[model samples]
Target: MVAAAILASAPATAALSADGGVAQPARPFQFTVIGHPFRATSDENLLRRSITEANQDKPAFIVATGIKAQTEACSDRLYAQRRDILDGSPRPLVLLPAGSDWAGCRNSAGRSNAIERLNRVREVFYPDNQSLGVRRITLTRLSANVKFRSYAENAYWEQGGVLFATLNIPDNNNHYLPEAGRNSEYEDRLVANRAWLHRLFLMAQRRNMEGLVLFTDGDIKAHVDEGFSLLSGFSAKQDGYAAVRKQVRAFAEKYQGKVLLVDSQGEPKATPAITWRGNLGRLGVGGEWETVRVQPGTASLFSLKDADSP
Candidate 1:
């Protein structure tokens, strides 16, 4: 097992305040890439081995993408993680939502039929969204068991130099979007989400941090137009996907920074898919999630290895 200790510690990035105040930034640490841990059920021991193996080889902070459950048992897996893995570790566990989490609960209609499941998740992980940051939870081994902040489509918060903002976007399956016959509830949700995202990004710019992280449960490739790229025609379009994509792109370009777009609803890789995680906007991803090394204000969409200090 290659589960070596910490390689190095450095500042990821930093920013400034409008009033000439120096700003805080993200902590510098190696980020480990782990695909959806939620799918590895009925085989806890095997799953644990696989997870530890991946971690030992990569030695990254846990990025549990698309780790959802078809049944309520999912929450148990999440809770058990604390005892099974994260108890004494200082490394953080970061996550984005995936359709199998709740969107897959829908029947043929593609509606969120997983209300019970959703409620259970919310209860277990987030009886309070204010602390959860959408579905992205950050658990540090500090006091109070670490209340990881949660944001809507766009909400921003800072931790050990790193700032995290999340987007609770509608599922690519259009499950969250209102149907032709529905009431205006979704409309209200849309307006709220839009305003929230804008505010979060703008704040990051104002603080002169590094860049903002925009996390969603769905795949960014899914937001692209049909036949967006030839290699994997699996990318498709949905109702709000286009608009959100445009906004993210514009924000990054305007600030000359980067946006960290995460695909929470990842399927699996025939081979090792997430071995190399880096800036992927041009590859159809918006910004390099890994680049905002020290802070969001000075957000550079480049490689950390390209960083000057370390």
Candidate 2:
């Protein structure tokens, strides 16, 4: 297992202002986001290639949005292999779990083993308060809170006057289950997520951060106001992301800084794009990877470019 570092050796991107606010960097800083590097069971080579490409650009940090493909088995051996792969990054690398990481897991009896698998994922990927890589950065995990001790994967950090966080919203409909007594996992996690969002927004507001960026596997933007259907009666499928979306919208409305939501499970696009609605922006990254530049004090606080661009 990798050990935690008190602070990263990377150059300082942000500093504390005289007034105790977070000061912007002298210039814009860039970071890369790798969307589902392991797109297939045989994509280990692809994952390594993606990391090498991102490393060549020397971004402040790298965020890989998923560990394995849905078809991959959710087993300890596979998880260990992926963890080793992620640990090879020379730059600080933050990981966000995808639905395939846990949602469809099953036990020997063929029963849903999602919770057990999710915990195993947490144990492997988020055992400490630092990112995986040769150069590690400190992070604040939700598990620091005694009440939400199990959600170590929900982590947040700051860089260049921006607050970045990862939420456990998976691509499999937030892992919602329609069966009456089968939604305990989803319901419990929903509560934890709401509290985590509240804490993140409040921290950004207090620190006077320039912008807030969120990373997750699911496209929360696609589920805004996605209401329930009456046709299916009590068993009707509900929008698992509704509560979190509502919270994000409310927080963004009250926040003075820009809000960017990034996810990996969006439709594959020829070019990565970000759609804006007032201060709120939604970026659905597809293809291999996307790099976003954060320019503090600019009208458009953030800008996106394909990682493959020259």
- Top candidate when judged by TM-score against the true structure: 2
Cα RMSD, each candidate: 8.4, 6.5
lDDT of each: 0.41, 0.79
lDDT of 2 by residue, 191-258 (tens): 99999999999988887677888998887773233354323344334867767877898998898777
Candidate 1: tens digits of C-alpha lDDT, residues 109-165: 555455444444444543333332212344321112222222222334554433455
Name the candidate that leads on lDDT.
2
What's the true lDDT of residue 305 in model 2?
39
How high is each candidate's TM-score?
0.57, 0.86
Q: Which 10 consecutive positions of candidate 2 have the poorest summed lDDT?
A: 1-10
